[model samples]
Target: TLPVLAEPRAAQDLGDWLRELQAFNLSAREHAHTPLSDIQRWGGQAGQRLFDSILVFENFPLEDALASAGRSGLRFETQGSTGLTEYEMDVEVSLRQTLRLSFTYMRRAFDAEQVAAICAQMMALLGAMGTSPAQTVGSLSLLGPDEQAALLALGQG
Candidate 1:
């Protein structure tokens, strides 16, 4: 495990947090080069006690290029070494139930309703930041006025 920074005040600023996160990432990558045999041995010995959940983030730079180039001629091969199915194959082989959330920053059209909802939430979050800039991000309210009232009522009940 990487060492946690003890500076909460420093982490309150987004820029500082980002810098610390980058430092942690560098430390993690430096420590990540363990032998395959050691990993296999650990997994083999770790019998039935499997982790129930995991979060995965993968970077596919070519995906944007492929999307821009148009995917009509693009054949999605399921068995290739570097194909999109690699992650699927891992999931199948591991027999793990995974829920993946993919967020991309490309100029692709999304469902209008979903996109509007996302934008509204972002606006709400920005408004929250404006009202309470000094508060920690975790303490900010992301809910709309109605939802906040409902939640307050529920809490009172």
Candidate 2:
């Protein structure tokens, strides 16, 4: 889990946005369960595990939104590994359903393009919210041996 910043305001104000958030979370979760057009969309076991983890938490019993909800939230990120590159995202756990958005950054390095996309996704939680954009800190190392070869093949293609 990302270290909780413990914004006293987040506790107070987060409840502030629960009504709208619950609706969005419901819609996002529905989209998640729909059949995938592509096989890669299933992402095998690791991706399945992440999705399963987020689903264990159910929305509050209310058909209406929970104004003071316990856990509707989400987490998403981009990463790389072995022979395949993948993107993963899921809604967070919540008393009400949550929307987690995660994705893999496919490449040797994470860059501004990736950061921008993430920022846009965060804004989705609340129609009105603040943002502290990030700057990529340092150089990145090579991809794993298999991924490197795949990239090389793509470049040559």
Every model's TM-score = 0.39, 0.22
Candidate 2 lDDT by residue in tens digits, 1-157: 2111122233334444444456665656646655543323555533232321121243453333443342466333335544222333233334435443333343544565864555454444232232211211111112444555878999999
Top model by lDDT, which number?
Answer: 1
Which portions of model 2 miss their true places by more than 4 Å? 1-18, 38-85, 88-104, 108-157
**Candidate 1 structure lDDT:** 0.49
Worst 10 residues of 1 by lDDT: 86-95
List per-prediction Cα lDDT, in the order shown.
0.49, 0.39
lDDT of 2: 0.39
- Model 2 clashing-pair count: 24
